[model samples]
Target chain A: MEQSKKLSAGILRNDRLMADGRTIRYYDTSGQNRSAKDARPVEKQPAIGELRLDPLVNEWIAMASHRQGRIFLPPKELCPLCPTTGELLTEIPESDFEVVVFDNRSPSLRPPTGDWALPDQVGPDTDLGSAAGKCEVICFTAEHGNAFKDLTPARVRVLLEAWIDRTAELSQESFIEHIAPFENRGEEIGVTLTHPHGQIYAYSYIPPRVEKMLAAANKYKTSTGKVLFDEVVAREIRDEERIIARNDRWIAFVPYAARYPFEIHVAPLNPVADLTGLTDQDRDAFAPIALEVMKRLDGVFGIDMAYIAAWHQAPVRVGRDVLRLHWQITSVRRAPGKLKYLAGSESAMGAFIMDMRPEQSAAQLREVVL
Target chain B: MEQSKKLSAGILRNDRLMADGRTIRYYDTSGQNRSAKDARPVEKQPAIGELRLDPLVNEWIAMASHRQGRIFLPPKELCPLCPTTGELLTEIPESDFEVVVFDNRSPSLRPPTGDWALPDQVGPDTDLGSAAGKCEVICFTAEHGNAFKDLTPARVRVLLEAWIDRTAELSQESFIEHIAPFENRGEEIGVTLTHPHGQIYAYSYIPPRVEKMLAAANKYKTSTGKVLFDEVVAREIRDEERIIARNDRWIAFVPYAARYPFEIHVAPLNPVADLTGLTDQDRDAFAPIALEVMKRLDGVFGIDMAYIAAWHQAPVRVGRDVLRLHWQITSVRRAPGKLKYLAGSESAMGAFIMDMRPEQSAAQLREVVL
Candidate 1:
């Protein structure tokens, strides 16, 4: 159960004047706790950490004194994004939303009316304080235990349409630079909410990792006169070793430099930056492939699978025409029951070694007649 | 239940001739399942997937055509690593000792193992094959429910000692270039095993990701005349944010570019490569920190937290002591029941957006009095 007791959460201090020589922040933590849920606006709490603005990277990192300790392990089935409610929570999107998407708490998700929970002070920045960018939830399905794999191919097409619709709508925000849509599945992945939902984060600036990949792609183009991914994909197709599944639109394969043990990348035959370029048919086509991919995953192991399917597209408004878009799915269930702990190497140094061969994985998937 | 109808284990065609063909493989469809609890020498069977050699990477991958439709999920409680009784498997290490390291029967875990349950056949390169390195399993505990996290700090310390000892011992191998040790926890992370244990993979190369990180570190050093991590730690200390705990010898902080939401990095104040440099006292000191870190983590969530505490040390025989050694502890738990999914940004483009402000998290955690 999430914390239903919402204290009077409002920031009281705004003294930006130089207090200490260092960039120290002082916040008041006095607030009233109210168990009642109201439709009133919840005051944002005080910022405890410094949201250092990394100009080059152009992002905000939550640098707080005790954050290291707070990065606790996740639970089985509770969503942090949900509003404070009695055991019965409200949904998102105040509108009779097909899926909950709301600036205000959804009726089902909201608590009964409560006294104004106002706090004495709040942090310098809240919400991973990017100074810019929007973070919101995208409910996948109303039912629990539902996933991208469960929907019929046509229904999955609707999901794709929703994705494109949201991409276009969110891209319209002036402050938003990049819209990232992704989903996490399975208890091992530490999913809080069992509800079938994913999230979209639109950042104000380009992240460093994307920058590195883009730079690499650009550099590879300059030197090789070809997209590195294209070359790599061509080579894989030529070898026919690591391909997990495929269609005219996409080819799913294990990457040569797989960070996780079971890594699957879905590269489109046609290169596009974001979902902006994806046609209705292309997305429709993605339905069966996506569902089949998920089912194939289930077939590959006979058990429900877990994976993070990230839609890697170009940043918003940027002319990333040359960059090829792809879907990267990293599964944590290469072995059964036991997880790959990421002991000394993979987590620390970014080094990875796949115990299983990609061809073997693909062959296993190929056997599944989804 | 595991797939009782056994597929061909795996066969190795390791030789110079393996490279001649565009791709080659051997298979073990029927093999004996050996229990890690007991060791027995048995003739193993051939698999459907042949072990193909990657010339450029100098590694062996499986070419199991039969596995196309095979379930990719691990069976519940039935470890492929610990088979009870079946046809003898193939492609295992030749060494006959107190404990033998063999290939996984599933046909892609390093070198590919065969079973005694089925008839076995030798490959073309079985005699002339040159293996990249060794893949061995260390059963941390007897009980299936107990994992490294469940083990006492004393037991964890023993595991750490095993890492050090095995790393040192394996580095001595003439053919090995890097010794990578990691453990994946939870099925969500694609872990199939229920047993509490980790793996040590001595590779013949410095993986691309490690190379990339090293290159970045070197570049940062050249520009700032300081170690990148040290400077980051200093900045974190000065900011009084992201720091979880620190003692005279070690400091733990959450990196601003945290891929996982609640990811913490534990590093020694002194610069060194690999755990070999740590004194015995330092090793002893690690036990409590490990316990405390985990304790604080458990305190926050009040659940069996799933985290990856990976040790990132310098490469085994690299000529330079370039990157400082560190341990990264990553938890995907966002709120109590919610998870931090590696959806779009982090999984695909390598970008991350943390929802919680680290300072607030730290304050919340610091106040917990762990």
Candidate 2:
């Protein structure tokens, strides 16, 4: 395995080859020497999936049938994300590690096959392209019980630096168009693993939501001759109603048209196109607010609310100047005992009917003590 | 309440006013006389919600905060859609009826307030308009516990007729741009009621998904110089692997790129633009196929699969000639106990990673003995 040079954040990066010829990396904050061998027997890698174009919606659907048999919620002793112990061998070969990232065993996308053909017809005749990209899992800690919110400020900063490095690294791939680092927490959100981990998907094409945002940003820029991100931050600061928290470096607010019961968007005051563009000072300032927001989310429902925390960044090769980087956290839990499911209207029509007003949600979130 | 004239079908339409100044209608197959009076006391109607434009996605989100307290999983005795019995005064006033259509007590959209303003800016200043549209509930039968698949062919035909009548009627309203008739079935899909009922949402603007489809259709026509609907149906007929069932008037098949675990699309073989364009023969021919498809969905897991059955129709004022009418039935049940929840990728990025191949799903559905 080829190892990259260490980053400037005092985190050592050790890369190793997994039993299935997949790349795995370990980020150790203590600068400890790491083992680069896997004791598990080698196995054949799963075949890469195919991407089929949905003509009606002008989107691509990655068909990964092999993922149906992926590991579900397993017992603690059988957890795949945990570090290898004396009796329990896991995905991480090391006995202990601060943080680790590896290619997913059952990935929706894979390395390019060098045959990229777009479907030419509107109907089903085996018109598909290779699902060529990368999907990697980033473990936040070796101990399995805590969440990203429970980590210390230093640990959160390390995680942030790891994300920034991965984003920059993945963006360099010619075929990858979008890089998304997101966390799906809690079993209610259909998280197959109970470990505190996030995933980074390098998509072959710009995702549908990002594409729409880019178009909107371009339109806003053309109409007003001002950046959309700056305008949004200015408006939120002026209103002060939906704003959840703010500092000199960043602002967090419940968006005016929130689609979920509880939704928050965190944006840096200094405009950056993506994570790589963030300065070290900007990264250091983000840790506390991220933790505070996540803690507030858990406090809202008196439980670890099932939510998706996604980073929306500019596309790798396009819309760099207009699209800005932000973090969106959305929870589907409408009440303590109820969840907001995407049913008829939301799932089919792509129209959202929010049950909670953004202002009320922001007020409730603000009332929570961290 | 004003009653519209009767149609050629002998389904007598009795329009009545609810206690809250809302409209309710009854469609009787036997021409039974309705009481046409509400026994319950009048109450204040919930205020109409607002529609906020989501500038990021160029979509409108209806904010109906009052709907948070709407009815959830109630006991069989308190089933709101059931007929009024001796001590149980339900939403339906009469003791017996074949079909009933009524205004939702807690609707996401309602009649406009005549104050319609598009947001001038792109940020959080309450740039909203009245949620101006109608939302109606269409009860398939008066029976307390029965799925739509259990309904007789005649009952399904009556329901189809009711949908056609409602679509044509709602299309005439200048405020309503799209009419969607959809059903969210099974408790796992967050269905509040167990009764056999569907919903008709007359949206003030074209829905996000429908708008995208129309754009794709227009683009396909411009490039190929052929109708996209005709091309799709013809291609599906040629490729027999994904076809589940077909008749002279309709064809049902799993689409080339399916997002859900078990998704089937039923398209009119004659290429009708909307439900209103369907002929009597087309309406009569749709019943058996609809029932068979629903039964196969249930048979897949040997349980009542949680699903959303949605009607994709052309916009009322535009895209009538380009967009074709289709029925999309998507089940979230990936396995017996597991469901395919839209988490990080699907929910945040609008990118779908399908667990099952469409061909395999079609094969499984085709093997079911319905």
Candidate 3:
């Protein structure tokens, strides 16, 4: 096996050299790496807002219109991601549609190509990936809106199957290392494209964080001579301070040092890499826990709670199979919106100074029968 | 000087030890140092989050309310941090208030009586260091509403003066290492008791991060044989990609791996232990740049953006100040709230993946003539 030399170049050796053959390219402290990038100063829509990155934490923040604020404050009566191109209405039908993957036609930007295909490289200026891989929408209903919280377990299982199907199909591209499918919901969380949908990004590289985790898991395996997550999941099951809800096959717990309040992680009883390993029963087992967690968030907060549902699977590359696949759900109510601060410690210093204890949170979460 | 005996305890020394007797402590496999000791909850506010230790990367995460949502959206008129105590109508005041430091009327959680106050050999939980320390409010204003962004330069100068007074007075504690003064604005960024006031936390030990930075700085200094900050700050100035604003004495820039959107770091030309070294002339020069950045953020988002204004000063106890005292202003606007997701990269994995480039952001910020 060729050792990957990513962080720097040159140093490559034998079996012991993991990420060694590929140079670990150190980004020059200078601004050169960012030089080639180009951004379109698109006309800002009063309906939508401008987005920028918070330089400290490196997260993208959107500044939407006051109208958008009104939409967020009030519940969603509209589903924007609906409007299909070519005689398509902005309003989606109230009934179901066939599982279709098409280019987002009603758009200022979509990879302009003759054929319905993904770009080889995908970005702002260059159509790399250069295809859109598979751009599509999974409308559980054509009507206004609802989160996975409103979906029946059977419906959710269908959604999971859709996800599994998409992942498998997208993975055929040797260029794609990881495929991410995520969903955003409610006005509070800011869902402009409200047609209750999730997206799949067939990434070119194993994102930096996943890359690091692969290294850590490998290290853990080498040292303990066993799986690291196995130890963690067992230890968590034993302690139970952070565990919110768990069934026979799946467990959801608040991670230690959770950056956001009400951050939940749902994992399998064992590690899984590819969706090919998932049985028809796996979807049936996992969908309920996710829904329960969502219900608990809404029940506890009183109003619609904003959350990001992320499915972190192993990269399609060589070693992701041994890694664990899980979903980390985060809601931002850090004390009624006035005090969920990512301050100097967490932002610049990387220290998470949290005011709440996991046990107390779990007690409250577990108490909620929803 | 007595070494921090954390290594000898149940905690394993993470990373190799330094000959100076300094070693990074891993609480557990996750860089968390948990044992029978820390396992006993501190009987504090119902733990909303857990701090996970990452031994490999040597970082801590707060995982309490990991699933709660909508952190920064504030009440329309009712500011919750409004005073319930006395004549203070506005929790976040508009006018200036004199610097007042006194013993908190609230009962101490640690309960100090006699010998507890008199420091000596004591158990970890019984240690009086945690008790004697005081927390105060620097009422930035006397009137009810407004934030650090709203302050005039002269008013900001006044607040800066208060910071100097507190830092000098508190460093004499013999136990106090760092004096952390931070302000949280907008409901979403976690401003509990929304007063236009900043908090002062004088810690007994330098929280793990300050300690880590000192080592990184020391190592950077050793490798290059130059002041790491001086070299880095100069490079940032030259690159100008991340530079937010420049003043005569200080230069403000968004950090490369910024943990938040529109995060600004203000670094000084001259490095010092505390703010006393800063002459009024210099602070006056820097205030507008600070104000300018805040104004630009509001302009960029076109709403009152939520942010954390935190100061990272040298630990008061350990006299060796690591000349990296700066303010990190972070707002959570990762793509207009619609796509403000802290995905696996930033959350589970420590790596930061920013969608927006800093140079483009700097260009946008520079265009804002605040």
Candidate 4:
């Protein structure tokens, strides 16, 4: 297995290839001798799925049928994400690590190789393409029970820096058009693993929501000669009713038109096209704000908020100027023991009927004591 | 309260105003005297919510905060859709009816009154508008325990005819842009009521999914000089693997690129822009097909399949020729005791990663013995 070591932004990085030829990267704040070999037998990889284009909706649906057999809420003893012990070898070969990222064992998208490239566009006749991109799982901490909110600011900074590094590295792939780093936390959100981790998907094409946002930004730019992100941030500032939390670098607010019952948008004060464009100071400042927002979200309803925290960044090949980076955290839990299911209107028609008003939600979130 | 009686297509219809000034229409297959009134104390209606345009995504989100207090899974004794007895008065006034539709008490959208109408378009400067349209609840049967599949074919025909009537009637309103009749069945799909009922939403604008489908159809028509809906149905027939059930006038098949693990698209053999365009023969033929597809769906896991059955009709003011009426039924249940939740990739970015292949799902549906 190939191995490499590097240091960037005060974080030591060690990259190694697993026995099954999958890449794994480990990051540590304090330098430690990290020499580990995945001695386990190479396992057969699942067949990579294909992306099929639905011409009716102009979107690609990756058919990853092999993912049905993936791990689902396994016991801690057999947890695949835990550091390998002498008797039980896991995905992580290292004894201990602050943070780690590895290629998903059951990936929806894989890196294209040997004449497997994603098509630029698909018509009726040509509606299928290789699900050729990258999917990586980023473990925030080696601890199994600790949540993201429990992590220290220093640790969060390391995670953000690792994301920045990964974003920059993944952006170099020509076939990758968009990079999405997101976390689906809690069992309520269908999280198969209890470990504290997130995922980064390198999509070959711009996703539907991002594409719509890009189109809006372009229209806004053309009509007003102003960046849409800047304008939105300015509006949220002016209307302080929805602003829940803020700091020097970031502002957390309930959007004017929130689709989810509990939703928050964390935007940077200064415009950044993507995670790669974030300054070291900006990255350091975001950790506390992220933690504060997450805590407040959990404070509301007095339960561990099950959420999908998504990083919306500009596409690598397009919308770099118009689209700006932000974090959208949305929870499906409407109330205790109740969920807001995407029923007929939302699932079939893409129409959202929100039960909670944005202002009221903001007030509830704001009133939660830290 | 105003009352009127009429007959349409061998079905007797009666319209009456409730105590709260809401319209309730009852459709009877057998000639039964339907002269009951909603004599219950008039309840104060909820404050209508406003539609806020999300400029970032170019979509309208309805803010109906008052809906938080709406009924959620009431006991059978208090089931709102049941036929009103002498002691207990429910939504339905009559003692028995084949199909009934009444204005939703807690409606997300209401008919625009004086000085209130939906805007043709919304820009950054004008993002707020009245959620002005109509929302109605259609009860399939008077029996509390019976599901849609349990209904007889004759009863299903009456329900379809009622939808046709409502679609045509709602189209007359200048504020309504699109009409959608859909059923969110089973408790798993967040159905508040256990009664066998569906909903019809008269939207002031074309919903996002329908808008995209229309755009795709227009593009397909421009490029191929043929109807996209026709081509899709033809393609399904050519690729017989995905076609689970079919009749002379209707074809129920899993789409080439299905987003859900269990999804079925039922399209008319002839191009019909909306429900009103269906012929008498077409409406009668659809009842058996609908039953067969729904039964097959339930037979798949030998459990009552929770699903969102949406009727995709053309917009009232546009896309009459290009957009054809179809039924898109999607189930979130991937397996018994397991649900396919829309996580990060799907919920945030609108990128769907399917756990089941469409052809394989279709095969499973076909293999289910009914």
Candidate 5:
């Protein structure tokens, strides 16, 4: 194991190797040493997933057949994400920790083994490429039943710090092109674990959505000599119809062309290519609104809404100037006991049909007394 | 009301007007009159849905706030798609019918009122355009509990005839650039009605997935001087591993890079641009294989698997030579009671992570006794 290093925002980083040859990193604010030994039995490493290029849509599909046997909605007593106790050993070796991140045991992407060059054109019989990237699991807290909404602002800031540190560290890999840090909350969205946690997926190729945004930003820049992200925030502020929450450094608003019923975007007032570029003050301002927006979402329907909170960042080596960082939170819950399923049109045709207008959703969000 | 016209395959087409001034077309194999009046209360016409271009992805989002109140999971006694009885006035105004097509009461797209032109570039504050096209509901059978798998091959042929006639007719509308015929089955995928029915959407612009397929096909055609769809079917034939069901004119195979746990694509053996281009013999051979594939899917788990059956055809005006007709059926059911949800990686990043390999799923499908 390497020596513990000090990261920005007074975060102490300790990196350790698990028994099965996987890396685990602990980010603590108190700067405690995390050298506890993993007491579980070592097993053979699973084979890496394969990435096949879909010729019909020109996108990559990751086949992780080994993941079919991963842990599912386990009981609270058997939760693997909780800190290790005297009676039971879990994924984490330490008795307690502020924040922790480790390699996924059955990852959709694995660390690259060799050169990761892909063919220019793919056919039906083309050889599949290795999913030569990384997938990491980030535990927000050690508490089993707590949610992200129950975290304090200071703890939220610590989570943000961990995200920044991991994003910067993952970018050093030669095969990585994009990094996505996201949280899938609520069992309605197929969250296998009851504990509050997030995941970071490092991709060898830029994802399709990010690629589309990059292309759109570049086209807008060439045509108008203006950044499209800036224009979007400015327009949201001027319109004021979809703005739900705002602070000095950040704004959270429902986009005019939202595809989901309850969709919100938290963007910095100034241009920031990625989370690593956020200043200390900017990070401090983001924590409060982030919690407020989440509370408002739960308040609207008075239930735990199923949502996917995704961070859209620029590519590691390209599109830094045009693609800006934004946190997009979208919920599948349209009404009480009803979910918005991606059926034939949305799933197969890539056409979105919203059940309500964005302004109505924004008004409902704003009316919530959080 | 227009006179009952004789269509291909000895089918009679009857066009009628409902109380709300909507058009309803009934396709019958028995050549019976369908002039029964819609006895429901006439209300003011709802405002058409608006199309907002998402600048981030450059795709149109249909905002149909009126659809929120559409009928959902009605009891068997009150199914809207069933033939009207003495006490119940349903959408279908007849006592019995072979197959029927009618305008959706709460449509996402309406008939173009005037000239429909979209701006070349959309900004945040761009005025939204009307959803200028058509949305129609197709009732496969008048029997309330009979599913598509239970239908006779002759009845399935009649349904295919309706699809072909509708596709050819919708192409005449100047505003329509693409036509999609799809079925969303089971409550898991948000099928509001319990009857065995489908929908046809006449799009004013090419959808995102179709657009991507078109670009890929065009590129492949230019480089290889061959059609991409033909190459895909031919490759599936040569491999023979993923081929689940086949006939003289059609083949149903799991693609090499399937996005869903159970995905099957049924394509014609010859070059057929759209459903209208299919010969009578081709249509006859397709009905049996389609039923076989659906039955095998249900037989895999001894349950009615929830699925989306989407028909991908050539665009109304463009990509006719490169894009061929096919049916893509994908299920979210991973196991008996488990579903594969579109969470972070899929819903947000447009990345798909399959739980199992295509060959494994194909073998399972092939082993099922239908």
Candidate 6:
């Protein structure tokens, strides 16, 4: 293997291929050997999921039936995210690693096969397409018991670098439209794995949410000659009440129109279209703020908040300049034991009825000191 | 008080004003005495929620902060939907009633209280408007420990008549745009009260999902000179593989692109724009099919399947002819204990990655001999 590149913040990156033709990568604080051979036999990759255009919404819905048998809250001893040690072989062949990312065994999307299906056969006004792209799981640590907030600053910096490198590499794929790096933390959010990990989904098409944001951004630009996300950041900064933490490069604040009970947005002070555009300084500055926001979230209700921390980045093939990168952390936990579920109105109608006001939630979050 | 009106299918309807000036209606299989005074003291009405335009999606999000402390899984004794006795008082004042519909105490939307806020002051590109409409709860049965599937055919017909009556009555209000009568069943779907109840939300603006459907329907009409929903039902009938049940008046089938693990769509064979448009014969025919579908859903896992049964009806004033009324029942339960949670892809990006195929789910439902 070629010499490992010492990336920003003393992080070393080494890439490898798995037995099933999936890519795996390791990021280490210390430049160490991560090259390990897969002991398990090569297995046939499952068929790529089928994407059908929903006639009602004119949107694509992925049908990943193979994922039905995927792991669900597996015992810690059989956790696939845990590093392999002795007889306990896992997804990672490495005995130990600071950070590791591997292709998901049962992915919603995967590398396309040669075969393709026609649209007419799927259904009326429905077009069949391959769920082409990548879905990777990033394990923060092999220890598996700690939360992302407990990670050291150096570790978080390494994770951020890993995210940037992956985004840059994944954007090269001609068909990939958006790369989403998100973490579904806590069982309340349906997180099956207790390990402190996240997922990266490289979608073949611009997702619905991102598409809507792009349209809004373009509209805002046409109307006001200013970026929509930039205005949002400026407004939050001016308000100051919702601001959780801020530095020269990054600022974290609860959005004015939060859909969730506990929702916060962390964005760079300067506009960055995607993670690939983040400078070393930007990455360094974001780690502490992100960590602090997560800590504050946990402090609220004195428990680990079940949240979906999603990185909203500009689509790779379009809307790069107008759309700005931001991390949205939305928790459904309304109170100590209550969860705000997306029921009839929210689930079926896509009209969110927020239980708490954003200003009140921000005040509560601000009161929780790290 | 006015004499009870004998509605279609021998259902009796009696309307009265609550202590707080909210409307309450009772539906009975027989024209019985439904007059019972609310024993509780008059309570102050909650302030109307604010409607904020979510710039990203161009959608209105209802900020109903007053709903934070709403009843959540109340005990059987404190069940608000239960019939009030001499010692117990509930939302339904009548000591004995077949089925009742009353205004929600903690509503997402309500009649405007005349104190309206300005738009520009809320936020950039955000509009502030009163959540001016109605939110009502419909008790399916007087019993607190039974599912909708367990309701008798007579009771189901009465419920259908109530839905039809409410749709017609609520549509007369100038501010009501769409009336959504849906049931969030089981604790899994966040049904706060276990009193076998459903809810009707009369929204001032068209919901996001309904708007998309309307746009698609209009586009389809312009392109093919055909209504989109009618074509969907026709296509499903022709395919036959996804059909779960069919009768002369109504047919239930799984959609081509179902976003949930167990999703079934029930549509009238003859086009009906909304519940108000349903004839007496249509209502009678629909009750049995709807009940059977629910029974099969429960039998799929031999347990009460938590599902969201939403009525997708035409808007009050627009697209009444082109848009068809349909019932969409979506269950998150993937297996006996597993649920398909909206995690990273779904919750964050509005991209659904379903674990089950429509055909397979339909076949399973069809196999259940109910």
For lDDT, the strongest prediction is 5
Q: How do the residues B44-82 of candidate 1 rate in per-residue lDDT, one tens digit apiece?
A: 433333334332122233233332333344453344333
Clashes of each: 128, 0, 120, 0, 0, 0
User: Model 5 chain B — which ten-residue stretch has the worst lDDT?
Assistant: B117-126
**Residue-wise C-alpha lDDT for candidate 3, range B1-370, written one tens digit per residue:** 2122221112222222222222212111123322211111222332122334432232444333333432233553454233223343332221222322222222111122333333332111121122334445556654456766887776666567667666776777654556777776755544544557666666544555566556556665555565555555666776667787777878888764454556677877776656666765666677777788888878775777777778877666553544466776776764455433454334443334344445555666677766
Of the candidates numbered 5 and 6, which has the greater lDDT value? 5
Provide i-RMS per model in Å.
8.8, 1.5, 8.4, 1.0, 1.0, 1.5
lDDT of 4 by residue, A58-139 (tens): 7889989999888899999988888999878999999888989999999999988865565655565566777988999999
Model 4: residue A293 alpha-carbon error in angstroms: 0.4
**DockQ for all models:** 0.13, 0.76, 0.16, 0.82, 0.83, 0.73
Model 1: how many Å of interface RMSD?
A: 8.8
Per-residue lDDT over B260-350 for candidate 4, one digit per residue giving the tens place of the 0 to 100 score: 9999999888889999998877898998989999899999899999999999988998989889999999999899988898999999999
Candidate 5: segments with Cα more than 4 A from true spot:
none
Best by DockQ: 5
Quote model 3's TM-score: 0.63
Ranking by TM-score: 5, 4, 2, 6, 3, 1
Chain A accuracy as TM-score for every candidate: 0.71, 0.97, 0.68, 0.97, 0.98, 0.95
Q: What CAPRI-style quality would you assign to candidate 2? A: medium
DockQ of 5: 0.83
**Which TM-score value belongs to model 6?**
0.96
- Provide C-alpha RMSD values for all models, in order: 14.3, 1.6, 15.2, 1.4, 1.1, 2.3
Among these predictions, the greatest TM-score belongs to 5
Stretch of 10 with least lDDT, candidate 1 chain B: B15-24
Q: Pick the winner on DockQ between candidates 3 and 5.
A: 5
